[model samples]
Target: MSVFSRFFPQAQVSLVHCEENQVILTAKNDKTAESEKRQIRLIDLAREATPATCNLNPLLFNGHLQTGWTTIKETTEIPIYYKRKIFEQEIPALAGQFAVDFVVPAYPKTTDPEATDEARKYTLPSGLPARTTFFSKEELAALPSNDTKPMLVALHGLTGGSHEVYLRAALAPLVLDETAGWEACVVNGRGCAQMKLSTPLLFNARATWDVRQVIKWLRKTFPNRPLFGIGFSLGANILVNYLGEEGENCLLNAAVICANPWNLDVTNIALRSTWLGAEVYSAHMAVSLVNLFNQHVDELTHHPRLNVDDMKDVKYIHEFDRAVQCALWGYPTEGAYHRDASSTDSLLAIRIPFLAINAEDDPISVKQAIPYDEFKQTPYGVLLTTSWGGHLGWFELGGCRWFTKPAANFLNLIAKTIDLSVTPMPEKDKEGLYGETLANGSIHKPSHPSVFYPVNRKLSMTIDN
Candidate 1:
């Protein structure tokens, strides 16, 4: 051992690194007990070796404490300037339209004659007047092509957007540092970050359609730039699903998914199983959902399928999904929606380098919900399960998120290793991720395209509830 290592021995940990064709395929006849045992084995063997270790503040060691405490913790001191850009997505929604807003770092302009530091003061521009200095589609289209610096596209957690403190904190270090030479944008979910819902819909776990359009627009607008994606919680789930659906055609060179709930069914079960999960976390989530729903009640009330009255008694997230998400997404039952929306199956089809960071002690996403075997078998997937970090709470000594530096480093590594000359061809299927086979054996197509078999190859089969 080296002298430094001998003096202060480094802590050791295990990690699951999935290589191509390295999966332990399960037989159809395998018993449930056997599967459970295999999952347990995977968990025991896998460990985290991330450079950014979770040395949380001594007072916030507990999973629940780490999660709950960080939400209210003061973290606005991080200096990062931001401006907004809205993409008019032509998806199926009210008035035949939808919108996605991206919060991009505001770098000091060297070319624009009128650019001022005051123009970059606002980190979030969602509620600002329509006539603000925010860049419009035309303005962004006219910008010079940038193939030199890497681009990081990020997504936030449940009911969160660019304005969220956790989102900004994770982004500050890379975007603010000129040496990093990295530019970033945060894709705000519909009706999030004080943005009004133009349609009768709110974003759900299965809401990959919105992200897909944003990514397409991004690629078209900023062609040839090295693009990477990083998502937290709900956004992670959406990004994973998008990757899986796109398969080799996915535009981003690499992706990082943090605190993702691989299986929504497991997440719902875990939440209701404990008093803290149900009363505190799930209940709080339900309140946020209800508030978002109330924001567009005028438009939503006219929707044919939505049971607006049913939303009144939503005390938990599942209930809110049943009342709102199920109807809008055409799910027959809440369980069905959760089953389909999950990114567990999506892991099988991801063609890019995928790094997933989860905390074993995360209370909301819960350790049990993580699809260890799926990640273990993914051809380019790496799972880093830390000993402690609750939900999105990975606070270090000075209130900075432990995952920020590591996430940026991983994206940078991918940019360096991958060939940036050729863009991967995307799968032609543009509908959705799931489809049904009728009794007659012909494929049944829904109003919203759901079933996707990646190009000519199928990675995994999704069971419809």
Candidate 2:
């Protein structure tokens, strides 16, 4: 031992992981065989190591005090920075797995059983069998009793359910309120969350039929109530595609999407790239998808279209899509499915107010993968790109997540823009329709292709005088 170490007899501290402003450390002492470990404030460690160099601004580093959005530029800003340094962006991005792994201890834990017990499950009416879990009226008591308030429909990512950590975190900000509180439900894809598939069909990024059924059911179940949607990752891609496909006829007043892989082909390429992308992300997702398929292997093997022998060696996401998803869905090949499934082609068709939030440093969906030009072209869509917030890991100190509040705020803002109380023009007026004046004083003629048309034949509408 060095003379200084012998005199001081201090325990050796090594960093296990450093995420944003938090550092997990393991300490060992020559005097004792046991090792001690704990999480400490990174700023404190920096100050202890070099006080003069470690003078971090509390506004940027203090997690408890740091709340609310940092307006970096207009609608886009650095969202809830645990550490404001540019180089430190990767810390939280890489720590996403750690956050997810200890989700129970990090945040209030909820399981599938717990969620099912509190919710009313209903199978959606669609070509392919799917399910939705609606929170009981008792659980949503904070919402307006008269159904004036909007319902929040959330969609989970690949291999995720309503009880997933990120889903729970996203819904944390919602609570019972007279006007502001929104009732929520999770629209699970076919075979997800233990929902038995009645058909041999499953959902893909471009498949919006299940979403349509869920919205239709919600509208029928709760008349006059507006609807809003929030989708994560794969779910986000589906929502975006649905919005594009339905255009002005969409039931949703607004939507908030996070970490959407708009370009499936590009995203797949990124996942299959080098050490971090291939070994970390692609391998992890591939394993999860394969395991999910394995659960239904007996039924899948019986299907004449699917090659059971090919599925046994499925090791990559592309392989799974090629072997099972594409074959079952009747797509000629995986490339065809990916091409049609990409939401980028349909972004311009979306008419409702929508917000898409993505982290620039997100490892799975690289910064270059986003279609910034397309976002600029879309009048109603806003892209909020944060410098650092690893894929779905917008974590703050003290277990406080950052994405939910801003998302809710955006939802509320858009909800105000839509006057759901306005009744549709009478069907008789459709014959004599010439031009209509919008709230913004823009006159839109029926000849205009972009003009809103009522899809429900029975619903009557009237132009505001």
Candidate 3:
């Protein structure tokens, strides 16, 4: 003990030492030769530790380090754990499940270059007041004739409005990718009162019709280009359902659906509330429809969608379900509608390469409720589940970025599957997230641990009935 205790007192001196010349070499600076040597050693160690499949491209890294594309498609070995979140179906509507995913970002999260009113709305569909929004996309706009680019349709989630354009702006990030080659159009569900929607979301499932309308409109206007659809939550379900239900009527060749629920019935049962989920969704729809009715209530009592009388003292979802969804969509009851409107059950027969990603534990998108057996069997559709993405809220736990890699990778996977060329999530954004809600109606939720019911659980949810 005394022989080794001279200058190296309390030190083993055997593991990390050299007895050659008694000279010590210490790293002097971050970019010093020693530091660079250590960096190379660390890089080599990292490479040695990496899995066989994780192909780290030194060339790409060098390029990025030189050109600032640090967030490009860097390969990682983190295996995919399918996340699936399930939400109960709307009462009086079908039962289902919805999930959230970390799909890649094809759009730039910045102010979109195409967001400008490049042209103008010169005509109104169905002679409506050109109500600025609705539950899904509409093919009513004339595509920019002078320019020939693909169309990117975006659908907003529940309680959303044109008043706050951030949701739409977040999506702007997806379409901004130069390789995607598509223009974006944000959809306002007819159920909200804020965007001046043309109708009521009472026809929740029928929202697919509106999305199809938009696609059809785009095809007519842009005849030569391809159309892609991207929808969040309800919008996703609506678009997927339309593509599934319409089969060949859909003009879309590809689509990305995030944080969606299928099997309306199962989803309704998976919520934190008894029927509060359905009640909340339905009540919001009722109020929006009621507001629209109120706008012309005295003049159009016979329009036959939803009326001032049916909403009479309606409280729970089942009650409102009987009045609104049933009365509007021609269902005998909400129970019947729930059976007919489930999108999960309708996943088969979809000819397009549709991608559905959701979290396994989303409060709204219940995962176990999805018909996985069928999803796995579908050749035209793909279901990629994540472990923790919440509702379309896939932001990394503390940071904001959530949907970039997942979406980009999914798009790339599909491109490979379908033989198309494209890039991964935008290399420009290292910050940001993707997500949803429906029309304005009477619903409003600001941000946070989005508590579902009591209209105000610690004050996260709010809807004036």
Candidate 4:
């Protein structure tokens, strides 16, 4: 028997990539790679295959598993599974470290400006500087002057900027699609990735003002385009809070959040309580924050509330947050900052379709910190928990990285659902009546003055007679 027959005997599999011991395989009928096919065949195969074992719920393995997103059943407890080897490498909080050690650094780097067609800077009302890098400008320009496409605005994680690996992964699916007419952009937070901060204040999980400003700008810039938000880690926390704070008034049509630190208090405690968390994760984060602060120390020293002496002893994330984050933001204590900044309590207020994905083995954002009950109760919120993806390190065999495809799929699904062409009808409705055929083969009449009708789901356009 071949590798496919031996391992996945029931399914037709296609090999995507292979290098030495690593082999990437996918379902034969995967839509994303329909045009591409690999010629390699599995020649050396054994009769007996080792049974794969991991903590991932068996329910997740069933079905086609296109994007690896298992719909949350009615149960509150969600089970996540990882391939045995992947699980073994996923040491809570150290998964990323292991990935960096083994995985070749072939992902797009910060120097690749081609990822975005244009870059624009905005100074928030509070004088904090932020930047937006846009994709698919040429495609947008080709459309009619009044026509607009759906836009996805991504926010990077802690100490990450627009050019980070996750942002690139999120952008890869839609940025080059001329037919889909989808546009993407990144919202770089203040003082990240060498960006100069005009104000002394750096963004935290509660700093929704910068994101709000970016959304407002995107709206003003492209008034007709439907907006969607995708945030990772710390950025995901901020997006979740912003959605809850805005409630029904939130401008986003939908959202996808991955590896969010829903409960900062629990996350901070986890980071300090364990050897892996303290030495690997917290140390890395603290160093990045310290470097950023030191680069802007001259300007930060002038801020009335900040005490530079307190920052000297900050060796861990909790200490850093207490000395600088809480102090700069005017929170009396670190506990107060973590409590107030957490998005878990705020999830209930979100009214728009929101998907939050977390890994149970995630070292930094402890699985216990996830608010599954709240997620289940929230009307528009969907939670997907996997057993083994380590803190944004969802790498698979054969060079495939997970998370991005599912995120892109979610974005596309929501983009199709939004009604983009709702226009005012003329006084004589009957005179301008026109029949438009929908995907379901139903005729939609836009003759009525105030009545809404479904148009082609694929194309968000509607006819106003």
Candidate 5:
């Protein structure tokens, strides 16, 4: 399947390149790609939009690098932090982020396996209990006996799979454990079976009000340990907004968000109007929401509000917006809700070390959406834009184990931020081309070296305890 077809069914990939500050993706297809081939669907964007009525920065001053003005027949002196390039490597794509040895030890036949036992007390409507998994602190305990390791809470983006599935299946064992030495706890944010979200509280932003409660419990149980939060897309938006409003009060040391839609109103509108933005992008989100709400008897039979069938011809975001608005509040549009829930206006107030990861190509997170001037000047916030990684799609560029190394690097930044010197990997007989040390003290040399060119940024962040 084409990259666009696999990642974003609705939008077309007119252009894909590693731009300096972000990955630039121009839309060519906005209709949903076939479901069987869909990988991860992100919202889409137009190269240009309805003249932004919003006056973003009154203190508006733009600093552009020469390339930012390329072919424009003018010279501007905005600083270019890094060079932009389009790279294609000839090698089997084995990124570090996806490299994990999945081993499920046989569940030793339980002595007395009972469905309704106290040990299995956390029952689900699906007849499943609050399933819990405890990851060993071996890596953290070994990081340094003198200090406590930071704990990382991973929240997945929408439909990105198990709310905490990514953490348990991919991050915990493979990347986070060996390198960062973080105590990784993957919690299934609401609607997930283990930690099901109340039906009344599922779709709206207020649902996030509960994360603070979760953090409180974690802090109380594991006193004195520093905590870090990582969120993607919807999760990212929720986390950033929460941090902005609350300011990392109880146990948060640092946070990172990937592919977050900065402007909710524009994004909501874009998903309704833009070619790829609305057609396929918003449709999926609308479908998920509609399907979720259909479980509500009152919502299902209600007219004016959308039943799943009512959404069959629902193509644009505006229609979906109308449906949701009607169901949520007796309204016919996405006005009041947009103003109340969006985090676009709240970014200036954010005062934590927030690392936002986004791509220009991601439909949900557009370049214009980033309040660059507002965020860049803020002492505690920095936006890391990449060339590619669809929605949460920032994978290893070229043939490097894209997932493993880069993710490890980000996790390392978190641990390092806490002033903990992440132990460098042990000596390897032979290291991979990307320089990542293999776990078995031996490197698996593919037919060709994996070539991943990292956008070099002088990370001068100092961790002040």
Candidate 6:
């Protein structure tokens, strides 16, 4: 059947060489001018870039099928190998100071599976706990080998956190494995991952300060081990922006950005273009956003700029941003917020070895938004795109998610290749790409605020000891 033929979609990878702005193509179907490849061959580059074969499930054949199936599928397993410790981080934002959770790994004294059953018993309503074992600060520190492993700091997508099936499926195996010798910390954005946010401010695409704080804290806490970063969807956008903002001053040894909506403007348009995109994906996401807003309605309603009552009418994802993200962050409009928040411009500034993966058929993170030219210019960055794998869903022959294996392999390659002795540039010498004062004394904030709130400058931390 013609439909069955689509089950085995080939990978399409692209990377541009900055000099002369030359474009490189991988797949045979990629349309390029005959003059486009005067000196270089534009064919079959994906096979060399990724090892994973994209044999999509016969049942989940199309983009919408792959996307829908992956979300509802019950393949995500709770992490059972490691203990969890929640650290409360206080960071400054436009609205005020807010405390966010930094869920990290804490090891048990012994590997007796039955002994830690109660610890793993800590469960969420979703039945997939963000973490399995629970430990206090002192309790974690008391363990002999708790603090000496390599670190992987992860960030989840919109309205998602450590509990996300995609994240747990992709990350838990790599970090929780004792033989891998790695630990992970999921930086839960305010009001996400079941954390109750007190401040009116909710996280947006440009919310990188909290991530910066967590990364810096991790560096301070574990000065001896190497550090890596991986961000999914919205988290990927924030992580990339943070990497660009930090530039030479970022402490990450390597990073992975998966299913990143590189350009928010294109993504917004794509969501509203089709019936399925608008009715299903956008509507679903808007409801999730509204639900998150409802959880912190008590705190958010009191803000002078926010009309919490009116937020109930938000129908589209962009409308939700216009009502909430714009009001809280002081954006004049949703367009301005999307423009400032997009990571397209930030890709070229990144100096660390990183892999950027995307699906050509991602319904939400539309392929049109993929900055092919920008990625080509980024020397340390690699972009891998599959012809299938809708959004973050890459179900293979036996329902296996394909992206995780390649991601882990890429991170491992980076760990082996990079020099660990090198450290980030000194603070004074480096510059902040966002929320900083320019040389001419003009402050470059994320947006122009119509209403003023006390800017909380203090940074502090409280571990759930």
Q: What are the per-residue Cα lDDT tens digits for candidate 3 across 1-465?
A: 565333222201001111121111122244546335221121122122222221122232221121122123212222211111112223223222221111222332223223212111211222211113211112113223546455566665544432223234344344555566545565555533222222233336435544544556557666766567777766677776666644434467567776676765566555425454455444554564455445544433444566768767775445655776676556777766655666665565454556666656455657666567666444445566644444544432223334444444444333323322221111223111111122211223446454321111111211111
Query: Can you write out model 2's per-residue Cα lDDT over 10-102, one digit (the tens) per residue?
Result: 211121211221212222233544343222232233223221211212233322122122212113221111100001112221110100000
Candidate 5: residue 25 lDDT (0-100): 19
What value of lDDT does candidate 5 attain over all alpha carbons? 0.41
Candidate 4 residue runs with Cα over 4 Å from true position: 1-145, 417-465
Model 5 alpha-carbon drift over 4 Å, by segment: 1-147, 159-176, 193-199, 248-250, 295-322, 325-332, 397-407, 420-465
Clashing residue pairs in candidate 6 (N, C-alpha, C atoms within 3 angstroms): 16-376
lDDT of 5 by residue, 1-465 (tens): 888444432221122211222211122233645332222111111112111121111111111111122113112222111110111111122100110011123233234443235223332345432122221344223322334656666565553323223233335433334454556544344433332222322334322444554565556656656677777666677676566555323256656666677676767765656766665667666666555444443423533344555556655545655555445444444655554555554443343445566555566666667666655333445555544434543222221212223344544544553232211111222223322212111223356655421111122211111
Residue 205 displacement in candidate 3 (angstroms): 1.9
TM-score of 1: 0.77
**Please, what are the lDDT tens digits per residue for candidate 1 over residues 356-376?**
888888998888888887765
lDDT of each: 0.66, 0.54, 0.43, 0.56, 0.41, 0.66
Candidate 4: give its CA RMSD in angstroms: 17.3
TM-score of 4: 0.62
**Residue 183 local lDDT, model 5:** 62
Q: Tell me the lDDT of model 3 at 155.
A: 68
The parts of candidate 3 lying over 4 Å away from their true place are: 1-143, 146-148, 159-170, 177-180, 191-202, 272-301, 304-307, 397-401, 412-465
The TM-score between candidate 6 and the true structure equals: 0.76
Worst 10 residues of 2 by lDDT: 96-105
Prediction 2 global C-alpha lDDT: 0.54
